[model samples]
Target: MSNFINKLWGSKSKASKTVTFGDSSFVNAPGGRIWTFISIATLILLWVLSSIFEWVKPIYWPPIQDVWSQFLVISSEGFRNSTLLEHVAASVGRVLAGFLLGCLIGIPLGFALALSKTMNRIFDPIVEFLRPMPPLALIPLVILWLGIGESAKIFLLFLASVWILALAARSGAMSTNLSKVHAAYTLNASKRQILFHVILPNALPEIFTGMRVAIGVCWGTVVAAELVAAESGLGMMVMVASKFLSTDIVVLGVILISLIAYVIDIFMRYLERRFVPWRGKAKH
Candidate 1:
């Protein structure tokens, strides 16, 4: 009887091992895809139900179908005699131009402040005073100086983005490991060599983080700038829709802005992963 019991237990163990290691296709099932589909379907259902129930009335909450129709109409008919493609191009051009300009100035200035004590002392107080003021608050001055054209809008965007980016770069530079700097010096490395090989690489992660934050801030400022004075772009579309009580068009504009921001954030994450592989591994 003991022999028979041992045989039964041995057979059970063998079966378990087979299930664990042999032909286990179930372990590779696409759970992520399933969850994504379910989540999207649930959201659509909820949106449809909300619209059917007249839940957000008086304030002009449009249904998903209406928003889709509005999007189609805009795609077909255009806004302010400008095609959707044209508006998108204009907005994207402004953002890239302004963001690039901010980076060019902010990065070098930040590095200077970080490396030079004299410069830091001279500029830090002035920067601190200016940093607290919102970019939107300076719109009047921006308009007065640059006028109500593309120049003013881009200027506002640059102002909104530059300070945050500069501060980030300075912080990154300051926070670079002192031991690494000392080690580079001991190894007969020049100051430029130390900065390029030791400081910049170590501070790269922080710089990327700063860029992400700056991108979001820039996006918000773009919308605000367009709202204040613009004949085209997503913000202008929303403003026009609001004036005419076109809730569907307004919703479409809001969704498009959100979608664009989301896409940009995804691209930023890709960049972070590609450039900061060490940081990614450490996170896991």
Candidate 2:
């Protein structure tokens, strides 16, 4: 018994799998960085040239400077009675609220399903059925059920994101090493001990992956959800601007959302690295 525990606990897995990106390892390579910078700069230059030359009508695609000027103007003044920063904050708040809600409900439900075959058998079919439904499709139902309020928007985002996290967590739990579980059982480890020590840590990597995917989904869904009826948030701003043919503001709102999502994704990645540093280093 002692020998088994020692071997199980002290085992170290050190096989490092090499990860490459297609034909070129562009993740952090210097050449890749240079090429990326050049590509983006070239794009900007082309945009500026097209705008200057009037290649396309200004009404359809405003000049880069016009968009930049609009951004600065809105940053200093306000947009639609609310400041740019306020719109950004409102969008962020809704997304976080929805994402957290989904995570809270989804993760536990997933773990439960993984731990109990009865739960899995009962709920798996339902989950699979609902998982593919688009959040946009639920907008009308949510509005009818909850009204066109923040709750409706939050619910829509929650619907968009919950299934992803739940499935990822379930997959992680299902993929746990059967041999290790049997060994733990043979050692007479309590259910609680096994759950905390063996199950959760092994599942952290998958949970993080789910979180990344869920957040992106939530962000995208919230934008569309806000379009239903919102006075604030970037999506609302885009919709309102489109009605008035304020293409520059619409473009600005899109850029802002994209930038915020990118930053949030980076933060999530950092958290994943910090919390699950042993993701690929686990000893089987």
Candidate 3:
């Protein structure tokens, strides 16, 4: 089993690092670093100039100082009787809960469809039928069935994530190299052993990839759900601010959502590195 495991991991003495924006080489590259700095600086310079000179109406593009002031007020005085932290927590909580639940069900279902012809035949049509449908379109139906509550919000997020994850898992499992399986069989490995030791490891990279995508989808779905109706959450805060024509607050909400998503994706990539180090290392 140890030998097989080593072989499965390509028998490397050390795992090669996956390329990411934060990777040392990428960050340390003088040309790339300089270009990135210039790009961001130029954009910020333009924003400041536009705001200072009133190139755009303040209603359309509030000054950066105004956005900062709003943030300070909300952080201390709170928004809609809920603290800013509470609003962030509410949205983050719903996203994680729904995404984790989808993972619990979707990954296994994907494996079943990939590994068993009977399972594929039975479930494929249903999956195909639902996969292309938009999560936004289901809001009314979900409200009818579950009402405009936390359950309804979570359900929408779950729907947004599940199908994407299922497809990722199925693609990963099906992409496994047949030669490795045949070799395992020749070595008298039990079916259970081959399935776990061989297939699961091979599919993990794809599963992680799917997870990244699903989380983004869940984030988008949660905001839309909250917009439809919610007492507290980032989306609700944004909706309320927009209604009042508070452009600064609206911009702050958008920036917060984008930053949160970016951080989560970075964390996911870190996990992928730790668990599936051989990912992107395999020779085609």
Candidate 4:
């Protein structure tokens, strides 16, 4: 995970370090693949056994089939006056709206902060003040100010995701190679030319890294945002189900959210690999 993160942010150290990770040939070996399958199978087998033996009450941890049946049932009969798809759509829509809005504004602001001392001095304290405050903590104020509408939820999620992205963008810009900047100056390149051609290229990796982090942070706030007030969302579904002691549905909601977050993260990583394949390495 650490290696993956280092790769994502292009963690260029002061010295040119040649670090070799474990070879793919070894990791992809038949033996390694067998262990990987075995690990996953073992967990599934344990879950089946526990469910069969009633190690825990069915109410708390239902059998795999029960969850599956519940999923099918929800698909057909709907949950809390809405279909499963509707619930998912509600949650996904809110997250995307909030996340995209944050990115649209936060990314450029972060770069500006890193590039301009005046901008940094003006906004740094304000961002810092809010960064450490949990989005949930602001829920009451948001409700009072924005009301308990969709805007409140989106705002909370925006706050949840924005700070990390801003910080990442700033770090990436600051990490621009000083020697390269000086060389550009020697070549009589204007500040705007150097920023567009040199700094942005180096900072792209970190900007994307922050985006990845921001997505996770936004996801973390999904349930909290919905819990405050939501008509239809996976979070709302989970909350409503829990009211009837339906742990299966709650767990199912959790699994679905995890799956969605995982899928998005994978896509983000693919984008990073495509755009900045030369991560955490010095330029030739």
TM-score of each: 0.83, 0.85, 0.86, 0.85
User: How many residue pairs collide in each prediction?
Assistant: 0, 1, 0, 1
lDDT of 1 by residue, 58-98 (tens): 25688877888767777889989887777777777777777
**Model 2 TM-score relative to the real fold:** 0.85
Candidate 2 residue lDDT tens string, 1-284: 76554443442337523764463423322222445567889988999999889898877988888899999998889798888999999899999998999899898778888999899899989999999999898888889999988999888888888899898888787778988778888998888888887888778899999999999888777679897789899989888988899888888888888889999998998898788988766776
Per-residue lDDT of model 3, residues 1-284, tens digit only: 87665543434446656654566443212233445567879988998998888898989989888988989999999999988899999999999998998998899889889999999999999999999999889889999999888999888888999998999999888988999889999999998998898888899999999999999988877778786579889988998999999999999998998889989998998898889988777996
State candidate 4's TM-score: 0.85
lDDT-wise, the better of 1 and 2 is: 2
Q: Candidates sorted by lDDT, descending order?
A: 3, 4, 2, 1
User: Worst 10-residue stretch by lDDT in candidate 4?
Assistant: 23-32
Model 4 lDDT on a 0 to 1 scale: 0.85
Question: Whose lDDT is greatest here?
Answer: 3
TM-score of 3: 0.86
Predictions in order: lDDT: 0.78, 0.84, 0.87, 0.85
Q: What is the lDDT of candidate 2?
A: 0.84
lDDT of 3: 0.87
Higher-ranked by TM-score: 1 or 3: 3
